[model samples]
Target: MTEVLTKRKTLLEARDLHVQFASRGRKARAVDGVNLAVGEGEIVALVGESGCGKTTLARTLLGLERPTSGQVLYGGAGLDYGSRALKAYRREVQLVLQDPTGSLNPRHTVYEAVAEGPRIHGLANEEEIVRDALSRAGLRPPERFFLRYPHELSGGQRQRVVIAGALALAPRLLVADEPVASLDASVRGEILALLLRLREELGLSALVVTHDLGLAWNIADRVAVMYLGRIVESGPVEQVLTAPRHPYTQALLSVLPESPEPVVLTGEPPDPTRVPGGCRFHPRCQVLGVGRAAEVGVDGKCKGEPLAVLPAVPEPQVACHYAAATGS
Candidate 1:
């Protein structure tokens, strides 16, 4: 992982990022103190369960949501929020949302859909750019699909069009939120393959946000396990997925089809509007009051003292008292 970092340039980064919202007169910390990065032409997967703030983090990174504090950087420069600056920044950073059906306009033809970005950015050679993007997105014979509307295409084709739209802009990084969650089993692999091929052919970098660890294993160069509103564990895909140090990550992986001993977590994650003082995961953490944590005598701290935010580094990092105590 360190070698990969040294070899490639860091394209996009988040520093102590926090996104808060006013909910029922309380602050909901959707993205709390997250530090992450994606290198040039690298794929990083942000995996977590639903409502774990992965989507919010993705939005914040795309500049859709303003952070309460902290900053997002691109090419080592802080993001500018002014309308013109944001518009220019968006051209370099595009988002491929979860649902293709919703992302596309049923009234718009495939050509219009793919041409939207180039048009908005006032780029020339519209026809050529659209064709190139479509072909690159695996929709060969691009002219055949140009006149087709969203309702006229198959699920996989619609997704390809979505990818083409992002590709049309020639973005430096793609922040994909649940990129394949809406596709059928057979089609999911196709999109994943397209993303990989794009990275190889175009040197495109991606931040893939999904809950599927298997997806991460298949496509990601690195994996970040998010819980509640923070990244609890992250490292190289081979390291973190194979030997997860955080209990939350362990619990998540145990439910996969191949696990011999599954770990079942009780209760729901606490509300972000009222996060617990100690470890935010303490109430539902299986390792806190029993097993190794109790033996290591950090059980009390687990319920009363918050763990420091995990730093973004090349090596594996886990934010759990038990993990820190045992040095695993």
Candidate 2:
């Protein structure tokens, strides 16, 4: 198991951040008071199923989505997403979207695409910057691909071009939202390797959002498991993945091809807008499966605990009320 270094500076942080949207006349808190951080020279994966708000959290952390409440801090200072400041912050922290097809413009050549950020920032030596960025992104002899359009490249190549564009800006952090989810299995490793390589060579931090546990295992130093907009468990990759404390995390693992004692979740995840009282997961919780309004402890606390986001805890935070009993 790979272990993350203990002492590292935090590059970005989300302090109890919440991103809510009004959908179908009900409020949906896509990012429900998430508290997370990406340390310098470290890689963290936000792992969860679809609609768990991983992307929304990434957008908010990058200052692309305004939080309904709470704060996003860069180096411990609050972010001001005003046009000029946001633009400057953008140059320091870039984003790689999930879809290369939608992200890259068909009309733009690889050179043009890579050059756009430097041009927008009015940086000198656009040619050197574009070439170096592409080279760093593994398009060796970058000149060879300069004139090609998005359609002319393979899916992996197109994704690399997008990554190169981000690298052109010379960002310290990369918020990659499912960077390789669309590619063939063969190409996924290549892109993941590039990210780790960038971290080693350039001292870059990354917050990779994806549903693939294997991807997290492959690259991240830490893993944060999200369920219905809140992180239920977070810790070192090996600790979280190998010995998950949260019931949901256990449930997710049970279905894995190599999982030995998989815990199957009953019923679909609850609706975000209409989240249940007490524990949002109580309805589908295996701990409560014996019977609804089940009693636990002398006070029967499990029957009714207020439904609020879990507070910050020690490493490997688990939100389940019965995490201690169930995990053991």
The prediction achieving the highest lDDT against the true structure is 1
For model 1, the stretches where C-alpha displacement exceeds 4 angstroms are none
TM-score of 2: 0.93
Question: 281, model 2: CA deviation in Å?
Answer: 1.5
For model 1, residues 1-328, the per-residue Cα lDDT tens digits are: 6587658788999999999999999999988899998999999999999988999999999999999999999999999999999999999999998999999999999999999999999999999999999999989899999999999999999999999999999998999999999999999999999999999998999999999999999999999999889999998999998999988899999989999999878767658898887788888888874656789888888889898887777678888878888898
TM-score of 1: 0.98
| RMSD of every prediction | 1.1, 2.4
Show the lowest summed lDDT stretch of 10 residues, model 1.
285-294
List pairs with backbone clashes in candidate 1: none
For model 2, name the residue pairs that clash: 254-262
lDDT of 2 by residue, 1-328 (tens): 2334457777898889989999999999898878888888989999998888888899899888999999999988999978999999999999998899999889999999999999999999999999999999999999999999999999999999999999999999999999999999999999999999999999999999999888899999889998888888888888888887766777777777898776767877667897666666766777677552345441244546654565433266677667644444
